[model samples]
Target: MSEVKNRIAVLRAEHKISQQALADAISVSRKTISTIETGRFTPSVTIALKLAIFFNVTVEEIFSLN
Candidate 1:
């Protein structure tokens, strides 16, 4: 852990997209998205990669170990 926090869910909401939509785009289950956003689970590298791609951001941008 010890990573900088992200504003991912807030940003997603700002974009007005549902979790299911995001999950579809990222190729993950909606539960995964919910878990990540809620800090209940940390995603694996592959899942992180998918999320980065779906968000159109670099992994560093999406996840910071600051």
Candidate 2:
């Protein structure tokens, strides 16, 4: 189905934040970040909103469906 997920990875790298750092910032486990980046997990809207707020970008910029 060619689903798309986790553009947070790219943005995270651009900001030079480690997975653990982001996980801490977002109050999730580091493995959760890994799962999310790998598309094995989907975050709630609140998490998505937190991520967008952390990155200073829109939620749509962090996620998309293909």
Candidate 3:
């Protein structure tokens, strides 16, 4: 399977928010956000949508198949 690539860290930095803050905003755990950012976890569609909504961007803008 192709690996998933993401710009989550970049987006977080650009938005000046920590993983914990983002997780709280999205109603997820900080560890979940951290795992996703580190590429150790691939978020579900629901989580992806939540992240996109939180960032005011598209899921495609945050994640891609590499």
Candidate 4:
């Protein structure tokens, strides 16, 4: 099986936003963003879509299997 990975941190940095800021924008918790960023938790499809929309990118651009 492929391992899932994401570019959330990179995107956040590029946008000059913190985890809490992202979470607030997406209506999630800061801890949720942290866990996802650290690979300790994988976000649900809803959250993934929210992030993509917030960053003006496709979901595939943010996440992939490696």
TM-score of 2: 0.91
Which is the better candidate, 2 or 3, if ranked by lDDT?
Answer: 3
Candidate 1 TM-score versus the reference:
0.78
For model 2, the superposed segments whose C-alpha errors exceed 4 Å read none
Question: TM-score of predicted model 3?
Answer: 0.97
Q: What's the ranking of the predictions by lDDT, best on top?
A: 3, 4, 2, 1
Model 1: per-residue Cα lDDT over 1-66, one tens digit each: 485455569768777889999898878899988888877777898988887777778877777664
Give the CA lDDT, 0 to 100, for residue 37 in model 3. Answer: 93
Q: Highest lDDT, which number? A: 3
lDDT score, candidate 1, position 1 = 40
The window of 10 residues in a row where model 4 has the poorest summed lDDT is 1-10
Clash count (model 1, backbone only) = 0
- Quantify how close model 2 is to the true structure by its C-alpha RMSD in Å: 1.3
What ranges in model 4 sit over 4 Å off?
none
Query: lDDT per prediction?
Result: 0.79, 0.90, 0.96, 0.95
Which candidate tops TM-score? 3
| lDDT value, residue 33 of candidate 1 | 88
Provide the lowest-lDDT 10-residue window in model 1: 1-10
| Model 3 regions lying over 4 Å from their true place | none
